[model samples]
Target: MSAYIAQACTIVHKLIDAGHHISDDDLLLAITAGLPHFYDPFLVSIDTLSDSEYTLELIIP
Candidate 1:
């Protein structure tokens, strides 16, 4: 899980450094897409987050 989170962070950092404008919805989709199928339930739960409440904090620590 730590490796997966680290990889996701790296991808996000790279995307930002490359000057691409990624919206939170798109970012979350990308992250979830890369995760294993076992994480589907948790991802589905987060998909309902309001725009202002959406964040990557859950996987950061």
Candidate 2:
């Protein structure tokens, strides 16, 4: 999970460097969307947090 998150962050950073804009919420949503069904519980937990609390720093291990 940590590795996956790292890779996603790397890709996101590259996009940002290339001038693409992506909010942290959208980044997390995209990552969670691609995760397996087994991650549903974790996703549900994440969904309960306020938007301000959602960030790559919190999501990545």
Candidate 3:
């Protein structure tokens, strides 16, 4: 698996082990939502991408 996928899986596993009943969609959503702050480096490093990437904004506050 790609490093990003592996990292995401690890995060999901940890959350599940901690008793957070998050779905795969939810997990991806959370990551995508947080990516602006959390994955800024990765995003910036990839020059071919545009700002149109998916944003995670549906997360419950």
* Top model number, lDDT: 2
In candidate 2, stretches whose alpha carbon ends up further than 4 angstroms from where it belongs are: none
Q: What is candidate 1's local distance difference test score?
A: 0.73
Instruction: Put down candidate 1 lDDT per residue, 1-61, tens digits, no spaces.
Output: 7787667668878998999877666766677788888988987887787866676565343
Give every collision pair in model 2.
none
Model 3, 1-61: lDDT tens digits are: 2465568778888989999897755765555555656666754554344434332332211
Clashing pairs in 3: 33-56
Q: How would you encode candidate 2's per-residue C-alpha lDDT over 1-61 as one tens digit per residue?
A: 7788788888999999999998887788779999999988998999898877877788875
Model 3 alpha-carbon drift over 4 Å, by segment: 31-61
User: lDDT for every model?
Assistant: 0.73, 0.85, 0.58
Cα displacement (angstroms), candidate 3, residue 48, comes to 22
TM-score of 2: 0.78
- Model 3 per-residue lDDT at 20: 88
Q: After superposition, how far is residue 59 of candidate 2 from its true place, in Å?
A: 2.6
Which model, 2 or 3, shows the larger lDDT?
Answer: 2
lDDT score at residue 51, model 3, on the 0-100 scale: 38
